[model samples]
Target: MPPALLVQATAVELLALYRSRSASPVEALRAVLAHVERHGAPLNAFALLDEERALEAARASEARWARGEPVGRLDGVPVSVKDLLLTRGWPTRRGSRTVDAAGPWTEDAPAVARLREHGAVLFGKTTTSEFGLKGLGDSPLTGITRNAWDPRRTPGGSSAGAVTAVAAGFGPLAVGTDGGGSIRVPSAFSGVVGCKPTFGRVPAHPASVVGVPPHVGPIARTVGDAALLLSVLSGPDDRDPFRAPPPREDALYLGALVAVDAPGASDALDPSGALDARFLRRVRVGVSATLGYVDLPGDTRACFDAAVALLRRLGAEVEEVAPPFADPGGVLRTLFAARAAHTVRELGPEQRALLDPAVQSAAAQGEALSAVAYLEAERQRAELALAMAVFHRRFDLLVTPTSAGAAPLIDGGALPPSFAAPFSLTRQPAISVPMGLTSAGLPLGLQIVGRHFEEALVLRAALAIERESAPLRAPPLRAS
Candidate 1:
């Protein structure tokens, strides 16, 4: 394959090439690196890119494939970790000057450890908001991560760099964290697929200081790729005391996209494969463009309506539903602010001076909040989660616009996640899939939210959206 085409291949497609001996990991990695070198600085998608180690790893993977002794599910796939995740040998500065950039950095966050064990080639760390504290791409440390679709626009945050990298063809898979729409928001803006599984589905070492219970998840160009990465990411680690119980030992998330009891079905769900859309026939989808209280602009609302119609066309039993409950963003913000407050409380004067003003502002809000006020928010949070659970009892899935609008100009700030933050409060499994594009060619996202621990259902529906809707086109940023 030409290098341009190679740079654009999805992880599964790369695997197919490796299996057929038509390409090697070395070749793919070189093409991707070259693409990144040509276009990376403008996007500001990476905070630390280790070309030396990545090339070395890719060459090693090529040899393993030649011996037909692959180590794990993702052998040779190029993956990037968000800066918030501790990676062996790489300092995780987390887009904040407050963190020390030089490190003996010996530990790997749980997800990074899993990816390494699975033979993924870890190339770099993507940029994130300071401590992943905000919803836009700018950070005190890495400056701004721009949307590849339009350099003037922001690629939503704190998974900002992950989404831009995936969309801009820097890499096919990226690990992103979602405290409140960090993964999905960037994915929505960058026109990729991102999933925030049920809280604790993927273990997190070193607790989060942002979400009620933050999640680490996958961002990818396709649902199958996202599922493949998620399968590797989900499990228990001793390091995370709060991790969810291990999923079924044999769970194969990619299999969920097939919608049938059949062997060797996964191959048919890839980019060049026949997608099985049967699962949608069994899904009851409830869609609300506006989650009752938030207002959506005309373009966003129209795209959301069209997404609903597509689901109906694909055999889903779709209904226009009332918002499940009032927006719970206030409760989310209170809890979020309190966590940020606790995080900055002990920082030295110099460290505090280095923090994002937004972070300091949140800290102040949290410090001023009485324990009673914080406790009230926590109680209301539980109530909100329960209400959403009851809402799910009536429908298998709820679909909403992932962001308030498409990617806004960088200085204007990314569209707010009014539609997304509430689900974070609920800790449900939610995914953002590219729904459609606006008249100006900006991409819009449709969110598929399922009952807690039901990521497979969400993945299944996401695949349906991809197969039934117009195929997702690459963003205008094509580098070769």
Candidate 2:
């Protein structure tokens, strides 16, 4: 395969080439590095690119492939890690200038360690908001990570760089952490697939100070690729007290959730026609345009309506149903602010001054909360989670627009409203799949959420939508 074509290939496609001896990991890595160097500046997607080490890993993968003994599932796949997660031998500054860049960057976050163990070529660490506090991509440390569709627009973040990297073809896969809407927001804005698996499915080491609301998951160009990465990222790690124990079945259900080639009832059927039937046909989906509170922009609502129409066409039983709980924003913010306060409380005035002003303000607000208030927020969180669990008993999935609007202008300071955070609070699996481009040519996403630990169902439903919808278009990059 030509290097250019190889650079655009998905991890699954590249694996096929490696097995057939048509393309080598060395060639793919070189093409990817060159592409990143050429287009990276305009996107500002990378915080650090470890070319030397990445190339060495690629060479080893090539040798293994030549011997017909590849290391693991993602043996030669190029992947980018969010800067918030520790990557061995690389400084994870967390998009904050206050973090020391010198020495002892020795441990890998659980997800990163899993990638390394599976022999993935860990090429770079992508940028994030300072401590991943904001939805927009800019940081004092990395300037701004721009939208792939239009460089003048913001790539909704805190997983800013991760989605931009994948959308721009820097690599086929990226590890993204979502606290609130980080992963889904950017994925929707940049026209890629991002999955926030049920919280403990992917372990976290040195967990986010914001508590268990944060989740580490995959960002990819397609549902299958994201599922592939999730399979690797899931499972227990001793370091993460929150990590869930392995399921007794010892199965990675994602492999069976690949997109079906055809669009109707026949294609939706599981391998055993009797046992599972067509998965989508049996699924009950509840469509909530606003989750009962968010006021979506006109264009965003239109896109979401179209997505719902597509799901209906796929033979799934769909209906509009308001979620049982009220807006949990107040509770969520209280917890988030408290976490922010905890994050910077130990810092000296000089270090505090280095923090993002918005984050600083949130931290200050958190500091003012009484112990009673904090505990009350926790109580609210528990109540909301229970409500959602009850709601899911009647519905197999909840569908909504990922964000309330398209990407904001680069100079536009405000972040758009999103439907992603409530699920984070509930710890349910949610995925943002590209719906289509708006009339303005900006991307929009349809968010499909499943009951807690039902990642397989979320991916399977997403695959159905992916099959019926238009292919995700790569952004037209402006000349640097």
- lDDT of each residue in 333-379, candidate 1, tens digit only: 89878888877788988889888999999988998999899889988
Looking at model 2, the pairs that clash are none
Collision count of model 1 = 0
Q: Residue-wise lDDT of candidate 2 within 325-346, one digit each (tens)?
A: 8888898788888888887888
Instruction: Single out the weakest 10-residue window by summed lDDT for candidate 2.
Output: 260-269
Give each model a TM-score. 0.95, 0.95
TM-score of 2: 0.95
